[model samples]
Structure formats: C-alpha cells, structure tokens
Target: MTEPAAAPARPLRRDVAAALLVLVVWLVPISEGAIQAAPAAWWPTIVRDLGSISCLFRHRPESVSYYFVQVLRSGRREWEAIDERALFPMEPFGYRSRFDRFMERFGHRSDAARLDLARWLAARDRELDPARSPVVAVRFLAGAQRIDRARPPAGRWHKPDPGAAPVRVLSSHDLRESDRKDMSEETGKSR
Candidate 1:
C-alpha cells in the first residue's frame, strides 16, 4: 500500500501561544477565587476582566438552610405553619418560594418594614381562610442543617427537620398592637 503523507506540524510559536492562552484562561478563575477568599489583593485586574465575571459561581455551597412563616391566630394556642404555595399563589417556580425569599431579605429590612410585613401577613391570613381566626401575630422562622458534602442527598425533596435543626425566630410581631396603634393614629389624624 502507498504510504500516506504526514500532516503538517503546527509552528512552535503558534503552539506556545495556544498553550499560554489555555494557561491564562484556567489561572484567571483560580486567581480570582484566591483574591476573593483571602485578605491579600495580589492578583492583577488589568490582565483579566474580573469585574464582568459573575460572583455567583464563586459562591461556595454552604449549609442547607430553610426559611418558613408561621402564624398565631386570635384563639389558637399553637402557631400554624402557613402554606407557602397558598401564601404566594403567583410564584411560578418552586426552587425557592417567594415567602422564603422575602424572609431572606427580611433580615436587612427596617422595623417599619417588619410592621408592614406583619400587617400584610395578618391581612393575607384572613383573606386565605376567613373561617379561621384572624392572624393576631406573625413569625418568621429560619433553620439550617449542615449538609455532609461527602454523602449523597437521600431524596430530591429533603425536608429540613424542625426537630433536628435549631429553628430561629427571625422576626415576631403582634398584629393586634399594630392594629390598635394604626386605629389610634387614624382617629388622631381625623381629629
């Protein structure tokens, strides 16, 4: 059989440039992570456009945390967990519920915002089920369970155990007091 001709070899300069490009692409991300994690700022920003690069990828998956809302009705002794879907009926996706996201942002909100949220919840509770006692108080709860990274998740839907994980009350407000104050303010304004 006739011998097939060998393919032309790439130039040494071209090969070196290609290798350097690959090296730079890989190193930029590593350098970025080091720069962000450490206090030192040794990485040169002029070389790579780190500003444009999203920090979402840099987020290290922390412990699995869950946020939920509970309501204290006028006559009920025990707090009832509000159904997230019912509360946020317009929410399209379930990866994160609207109520949960609200709770996440709730930490940074002011006292006035808390009262607004409490008032909204109280009104919403009555609207959701008029037969049930009106919500006298609203409480936001947060719980986090340290996930073992080594182990695979048991199920697609993992319910964070309220019993196993320590539940924290992020904010609690008495709607009754707020309502009374609001009424008094309205009367005072009228006078």
Candidate 2:
C-alpha cells in the first residue's frame, strides 16, 4: 500500500500580499462608483474583499476593524457627493437603514411583535376547533375571480389622519386631467 503525498503549504507572506493586492484592485472602482450611485452597493464587495484579505493574512487580525471603519467613512463621503446627482432615490437603502436603527435602539419591539404574533397564534390555535375561525379558500377561477372582502375605493385606501385638518392633499396618483385643469383655472382666477 502506497500513501499519497501531502500538498505543500503556500507561502504565508506571499498569500497575504497577493490577497491584499487583489482586494485593493477589486474595490477601487466598485466602491468609488457605488458611493455615488448607491452607497450600499459598496458593502457586498467591501465585505468580500475585507474577508479575503483577513483570511489570507492573520488568523486573528486586529486591523480588520480599522480597515472597515476607514473604508466605510470614505465610501460614505463619496456616496453623499454622488447622491446629489441622483435623479431617483433608492428606497431600499433608506428602509434598510431605518430597520437597522430600529433594531439597534428598540430591540424589544421586535421581541414584542414576535410575542404578540405568537399570542395571537395561540388564541387561534387549531387544536381546539379547526372550523371556528374564518376559513380562507383560494382557487384559480377561469374567467373572473370574485373578491369577497370589503375594502374602500382606490383613493380612500391612502387617507391621511382623521383628526388632521381636511385640507386637500396633492398626490401624483388619483388626480384626473380635469383636476389639473381646474387647479390651473383657479390659479389663473387668483392671478
């Protein structure tokens, strides 16, 4: 019986240098462009490059945190400048940041929502009586599907606060061509 030869170990310094070099090369364009177009677009590649550098160098690196902070700051500034030129806003980034902040500050809210949902589930536990609760039956109909639930008409769905003053709010949607004409005519009368 013959034993297979073990693979030779790669040079640690060379691997680290190579990894760092690769990371630098990869991040220069993506991070720079992402900061202007989408600040968050930098994150995926940044994390990947950072991880690669970390793996190739230290088993327990200390500079990882420093590098991350530096990169984040630079990327943030670049993104701020880039965002000024953006015509359309990126909503997901705002939502993600909001959720992150919420999670950080009110960690309890998530738990509360979870517990509330669980309590609701428990109240509607199926073991007691399967048919007592409302039944939901979904099927694909051929021509026209009937909607059973009661809902407000289109414009009513997005109403403002009830207690607030009843001033008509302008919305891009739900406004007719006649409505625009009326507004313009009213403006002309005031002028």
Candidate 3:
C-alpha cells in the first residue's frame, strides 16, 4: 500500500503573527477581569474595550460635591478660581492633569501639606507675575450642585440658593502670617 504524501509546512506571515500578538495583548486584562469575584476587584483600567455602565439603575444618582482651590490675590476682594496655567507652566495645552491629581490627593490630609502648598503657590505667583498681586491667602473649598431628574435641561443642574453658604472649608492658609513666622524663626526670635 502507498503512503499518503505529507503536507508541506507553512510559516506564519509577519502581519498574522503581529495581529495575534495584538489580540493577546488586548485580551490579557479582559481575561483577568473575567475571573474577578467582585466588580471592584477588577482593577480600574483605562482600557474600555467592552464599555462600562455607570450610575445606571444599579446606582442611585446623587449630588456631586467637588473640592477646589480658591486663592485670594492681594488687592482683590473676591476669591476667584485659581489660574492653573500660571501655577503649572509645563502644561501649555490647557488641561492640568497633574494639578487635578494633586488637588484630589490634597483632601484634608495634613496641615503641613496644605500650608506648604499655599506657600509654594504664593511664591510661584510672585515670581511669574511681578505686576499683579501675589496670592496672599489660599483656601481649599468644597462646592456642590445637584442634578434634578424632574427638571428641564436648563434647570437640571440646580445649585444652592444664592444666599446659601459653602458646604465646608477644607483648609485655609494666610501666606503673610506664614512668611512672618518664618522670618521670625530665621532671626532666632519668637512671634
């Protein structure tokens, strides 16, 4: 009896191999996610290949309160939003991701950190803009606004009444007082 001829071996094309590699790279996170016991166990990843469901029927919608840094520049009576561009010069494109992350981590941790940040900001403002007044005081404030499901788009995002006060003051530092204390300590004198 004659034996059947063996088929010739073929090598995988470079493109095919690369495609397979890409697929595997994408699947690593997904495969690991499938075995997680809880939703939170799936480590937060930017890869949203499958999509995500947030604040759906699974979670009740609620008011969102956010923390922000408000600086009181010298000669200005009103406390306004900080000029992030002036503080973070490297981020010329406008979105200050570094500042945002720093702010998020700055939530009511230590008094020293808050004071240091305020002092640093004041110094930067002084060096950058010699013409304008530097930041004399820095306040870490919390603001809140609620979304009304029953209201129209115009009235959907409802802020507190004009007379309503802030939710709370997270932290505040007067740079002038800090500078005075530093100067006194440097001169070996107590304030």
Clashes of 1: 0
* Residue-level lDDT tens digits of model 2 in 9-61: 87899899988876666665446444443223345645443434311322222
Q: What is the lDDT ranking, best to worst?
A: 1, 3, 2
lDDT score, candidate 1: 0.69
Off by over 4 Å in 1: 1-56, 90-94, 107-111, 152-164, 189-191
Error of 2 at 56 (Å): 33
Residues 1-191, candidate 3: write the lDDT tens digits. Answer: 99999989776798789878666545654554454411333434354333233333444446554556678988888887766656765742234335544555555566787788788877877888789877899987666566577862463333233236465787889888988989888888542
- Report the number of the highest-lDDT candidate: 1
Report the Cα lDDT for residue 88, model 2.
21
**Residue pair clashes in candidate 2:** 35-79
For model 2, give the 10-residue run with minimal summed lDDT: 64-73
The count of residue-pair clashes in candidate 3 stands at 0
lDDT of 2 at 179: 46
Whole-model lDDT per candidate: 0.69, 0.32, 0.63
Residue-level lDDT of model 1, residues 1-191, one tens digit each, is 98999999868998999888766655655565566642224444443444234443555566766776778988888988877777777643356666656655554355676668778878887887899888898887778767677884675645465556688887888988878998999999999
RMSD over all Cα atoms, model 3: 8.6
Order by TM-score, highest first: 1, 3, 2
- What lDDT is reached at residue 104 by model 1? 56
lDDT agreement of model 3 with the native: 0.63
The root-mean-square deviation over C-alpha atoms between each candidate and the true structure, in angstroms, is: 12.1, 25.3, 8.6
